[model samples]
Target: MNQSNETTMNPPLNQESVSLEPSANLVRTIAVRERPANPGAWSNTVAFGWRALLKIKYVPEQMFDVLVTPIMFTVMFTYLFGGALAGSTADYLQFLLPGILAQTVVFTSLYTGVTLNTDISKGVYDRFKSMPIWAPSPLVGAMLGDVLRYTGASIIVVLIGLVLGYRPEQGLVGVLLALVLLNVFGFGLGWVFTVLGLILRTPGAVMTISWLVLMPMTFVSNIYVDPATMPDFLQTLVAFNPVTHLVSALRGLMSGGVTLGQLGLSLLTPVILTAVFGPLAMRLYRRKR
Candidate 1:
């Protein structure tokens, strides 16, 4: 055989193929390389979710605000405006309870966008992209995190309401059902906020723009006061506010007096809001890079 033929027969192993070689160093390199950095299911969204949970777990104090805020809001409204709104503390507590539950949840949902903006600005998402993971992991993880958040906020709000003499006629099952609806509502709302965060360049900007959007959605609705008490223009706008439908749904479930029509509106509103915002949010997220 000629020299050229001999060289072809005994070709040298390249760096990539050497990684799979059986020699100790080669094998070690292979193991280091062949092992997927972001492995399995949690590698993507589930991983992100677990990471967020762990972060919160390590920082237990983050939840303190969630627990305390509900109490503060209920107390503020009950003691300050009890007589003005409902004529007595007992009556005010009951009516304000539903309003507090709905408003607290709606406001808390803003964290989704605000937190998302921080993650983006901090280059954390870029790290996720570099890892060996699915595209949907962060989205899945963030959404799951929101579930826990909503649960904590809702439960605390309910408990505070109880301490203040705000008993739901629906009792335990009613409270649970209200929580379920709120959880579902919050879950969908997070997607909208996450997308919003992706579009907004700064966390403060996200909060500012979103608050402007959210405040109107909450106050313009029938949460704290009945729409009939409002001006005609405000009443007309309230008809279109999804928060009104959500509060109505929660109130009906809590009071054991919610009609099918109200329930339908309640469930329908969050879902529709999700649909409208979901696509835009995802579009904004992808458009980033």
Candidate 2:
């Protein structure tokens, strides 16, 4: 019985017994399924953007800054500096809301880099780099996801400003346009920090450097005060500042006086930043260890 069982299990290596070609039924089954097409760049970008949003969803703490800071700035500044600077909270809210919105967008833009840096530190980006998808999709998608954060912060500021007596001369249409412009500018400015994320080894380092740069950039501009109140040298510096242009544009859009030239100036910085640093960030991301 044992010998018979061994003989049945170990069949002879005859041509008929051990055929290399698959059987007809097996071949037919294999041929029925065609290979799926690879996803295009836009699809890849959207997928990564969804993944980024999921990260925010799971880690709700990621949104804390986006929510709290804008509200605090809107409330605190409107009341604290209102009487001294603009004679009343209502008047100050009129002048301050747009500037706060601009500042909120600028400040929130840094998180793109910070989040990117954190992902890198966790070694998650290495896996992203290895994926067989569009090369820039991860970076682009991450920034795209961050655009929503900027929008959320902007909306919060706008709402708080409205609650605190801020009213746009341009109304809802103007408010929407201002938000669009603010987000576009934020998207452009994000490239600078994206480049930083790729270069810096630690998330904290990236954030520190970002703060150092943004501090003077935001404070020296016309966000908090008119450039005319500054010294001539300071005014000259502020005149060149893209933030000043953005704040000016935001004010004009909300309060009714924005010009074509101001819009051009506000847009110039973002275009320049994206043109210069966008490629740099991509290169760094590709070559990063």
Among these predictions, the greatest lDDT belongs to 2
Model 2: per-residue Cα lDDT over 183-238, one tens digit each:
89999999999999889988889899999999989889988777777889999999
Off by over 4 Å in 2: 1-34, 122-124
- Work out the TM-score per prediction: 0.82, 0.87
* Clash count per candidate: 2, 0
Per-residue error for 232 in candidate 2, Å, reads 0.8
lDDT of 1 by residue, 63-168 (tens): 7766777778888878888888878978878776877888888878888888777766657767766766766667758777877888888888887777777878
Whole-model lDDT per candidate: 0.79, 0.89
Give, for candidate 1, the lowest lDDT window spanning 10 residues.
12-21
As for candidate 1, its clashing pairs are: 44-137, 45-137
